[model samples]
Target: MHESKLIIAGGSGFLGQVLARYFKTLGWEVIVFTRSPQANRVAREVQWHGETVSQWTRELEGATAIVNLCGRTVDCRYTTKNREEIMDSRMKPTRTLGEAIARCKNPPSVWLNASTATIYRHTHGPAWNESGEIGATPEAKDEFSVEVARAWEETFNTTATAHTRKVALRTAMVLGDGPNSVFPVLLRLARLGLGGRMGSGRQFVSWIHEADFCRAIEHVIARAEFSGPVNIAAPNPLTNAEMMHLFRGLVGMPFGLPASEWMLEVGAFFLRTETELIIKSRRVVPGRLLASGFQFQFERMPDALRELRMRMTGDVKCTLPLPAI
Candidate 1:
């Protein structure tokens, strides 16, 4: 009998590596379709440009699951070229995977595509859930990012895949143990006494721990009832000020320097990133997951931060070894 297999497209980054290891521990044959072929002991690596359907598509046949985490990082300035690349990087691969899955004689049981919590409008009122309104309002200052997310989900949903269950993962900021990830950056800022509220500081910040994020994906795959866009975030969403305060407390920083809108603009400019990422209010909630009996290990912000802090400080025993790539 053939072994169970999982295909993670663009599984070379921080999240992907952790996911690859998680599935590998379950004794599944893990195949990663990435552009660059790197030496990895745990998973098999296949080379494919994300936009094209190549021989890598063969791996999709009879696969147990396929999680599409493809897309360029939105950690840069939103220049015209950057915007185009950002949109294209997500849309093309999603459509291409759909086509590949359509061609598969034995398609995977589920295809979990990555979306963002930022798809919802910037607001402080109600927490945006799976059924929440998508942000296309002219009032939204960062409508461009929301539009990109809208198009990304649309391409995945519209694709013809009869045999496969499709779920758009509307993910929030994932707090993971990686130097390049947002956690480390925020940790550095906290240590430097720069972990302060940006803009009005009333903006909401939603996030999930890396462990819960992986587990949630697995839960979705197992439960046939979960479909459509599911918000992959913690239940307890907090204001930017509250979040920064918690971070400062965890890192032993008594105070953080608050930044106004103009100050944030200058800082973003210096960092070569956009301020909207930090300033935009994203009060996202995982209503569907809770309704579907998905239990998160890290439900609250303080608990999640504590675990991450311990991991970063080498106080807790590491569960999974860091990926070779």
Candidate 2:
């Protein structure tokens, strides 16, 4: 993949930084598009300040792939302005790239954009696959995510996807060996004896380790057969209660309290975030990826938890090592 330029729209972000390291190792000339003035000097990163798509629309020349990871952090409080920002952050960049591809003389062959499994309904039991139903009407979901997914996919399909071999990654919670993951927050809560399941602990968590996440993207880049929306998550999705139980065992702490749904709602309101982020149950399985013969490094709950804890504490007491993706 050396000098096989891959343009990352939000290359300076948390997941973007992880991808930067991975692609650099694979020898892909990574170009991170950011508005930050200091972003240009950051090794292997280049500045892309244009938001209107007219500027340097031709710069994507000779690119083999374009991975779009741009989006406003959805965990923050979602005010009217914040919601608009969230929608625009994702929709605009996608539209920008789509328009660029439509007009480019030499465009990228592949386009992989970031999406979430949260687009699915809150199902405690019913499982979803790649061929599952995608709701045309926005059901009882928060305003931000409701409109955002529609606009995003619309732009990707109508604009960029038409010109390129596009793949939308409907990713679940991605765990990695860094502070950017939700592991620290959960770990800290457990250490303080405040850790337990959120809400009823019935919601399923479909997760992928950072290594596998990167590997999956690489696979998509190499395979032209994978197009459309692919579920970039682990097949085994444990219930929130079971996941918390594993955390308690790994951290060697007692489960203190289960976060109440009402409390979560109140907190979401206060935090300016959508409570659906906490309460929504997504039991998504990687049917397509598995069918495509993708192998998982850490497929089980206890194993993923144990290794994640060790990486965080810098203390290796167990025999199990980090699983290779």
Q: Write the per-residue lDDT of candidate 2 for residues 1-325, one digit (tens) a residue.
A: 3368888878787788888788888887877877773544333555565367766565587788989998888887777888888888888888777877888888888999888776666566567888665552333354457567767877777773455799989898987766567777777777787678888887778888887889999998999899988888887888877777666666678555788878878877886667767666778888888998999887775677777767767778844322222
**lDDT of all predictions, in order shown?**
0.87, 0.76
TM-score of each: 0.94, 0.90
Residue 232 of model 2: what lDDT?
86
Runs of candidate 1 with Cα error greater than 4 angstroms are 136-140, 316-325
**Candidate 2 at residue 29, lDDT?**
80
The best candidate in terms of TM-score: 1
Tens-digit lDDT track of model 1 for 74-188 = 9899999999999999999999999999999999999999999999888889988887877754444688899899899999999999999999999999999865478888878
Worst 10 residues of 2 by lDDT: 135-144
Off by over 4 Å in 2: 37-43, 54-58, 136-144, 160-163, 318-325
